[model samples]
Target: MSIFKPRRKMVVNREVQYDVLMYVGVFIVALFIVQVFTAYLFLDQVQRVVGTMSALEFIARYKISFLVYQIIPVSFSLIVGVYIFNRLTSRIAGPLFNMRRILQKARNGELETAEIKLRENDYFQEEINDINVILKRKSD
Candidate 1:
């Protein structure tokens, strides 16, 4: 499908892309830490209530349930989150990259051809539209 067509370049703005990715990475790490801590606390409470099993023994016995209930969900969420963030940052960064190129062309007295036409899904459409109007008047 047209929507699935690959772009010529995935990382048009390296700085923005990497920065957003780093933030997402940090968020995922924080989430993982919280999940592990919460699971530990829950397991600790269960062991105390049972008064027979050690925490490690409980974990070892119910390892499959732990994996099914906690690890799997977190891993799946991380995958989905990364995919969504990548798409969102691309939409933002692609337009910014195009705007910079259009500005460079305008600086070189190429205003007539320096139209700011971004992808339909890209951010800054309204801003680019306003800029294109100004460029049109200047070229005229």
Candidate 2:
């Protein structure tokens, strides 16, 4: 229902590649917000220098278009940010989610003997190996 839902499921120990991409995405969002603020400041200064009525006239003339330009990027950032974060989180969370469900089955003593598989794009190979090791030890 929300990003918060995925947040709860998101694996704490993610691969380095995922960490890098996630941080980079966050940095871009921050950079974009800063750019927007800087643009606002520049526009404000231009309006002040040009005098209020003239600035008001200019804004009135191009208000719709100007607003669209500003809104589009932020709206895109919001949409793309949610999408990227969702995907990024999913790549991490999905494996863990699968593992959790499998673990639940294992707890019920209904697990298959085959090693738990991860998606090609997913992480936690080390954890998977560890799980397999435990299973091997248990079987012996």
Candidate 3:
């Protein structure tokens, strides 16, 4: 048997995953706005010090450079952040989802053949194991 089993689904809970992603999305948007504003202020200061280029001229000349240097890196970081958060949230959500189902089965007295089986890397193993022991005894 393979020691590692990949998760078939990226999302275990839609509400939870979307909520997390939404918060992250909001934060990223705010961060990007602040960064762009700061960059613009710095560029304006530089133009004043140089006293050669008008604001419009400076922006027109360096817009491509700003996109290349700033937007691309921020976009890449946001992509990576979303991926990492999705995986991290899935690890927590997957175990909770399983636990809820298993506990519900126990409550309904349909746990005779049920066991709380979790992935190797999953959280809450100890808690689930304790519940399993109690359910096994009750069924016995």
Question: For this target, which candidate reaches the highest TM-score against the unseen true structure?
Answer: 2
Worst 10 residues of 3 by lDDT: 41-50
Pairs of residues at least 3 apart in sequence or in different chains that clash in candidate 1: none
Candidate 2, 35: how far from true, in Å? 4.2
Candidate 3 per-residue C-alpha lDDT over 111-136 given as tens digits, one digit per residue, 9 for 90 to 100: 67668788887656677788778877
Per-model TM values vs. the true structure: 0.57, 0.64, 0.60
Worst 10 residues of 1 by lDDT: 41-50
Please give the lDDT score at residue 47 for candidate 2. Answer: 64
Better of 1 and 2 by TM-score: 2
lDDT tens string, model 2, 43-70?
7755654554675687776677566667
Top lDDT prediction, candidate number: 1
Give the runs in model 2 whose Cα sits over 4 Å from its true position: 1-53, 112-114
Ordered from best to worst TM-score, the candidate numbers read 2, 3, 1
Q: Write the per-residue lDDT of candidate 1 for residues 6-112, one digit (tens) a residue.
A: 75767655755686778788777867886877588657756654568777887687777666667666776778777878888888889889889988989898666
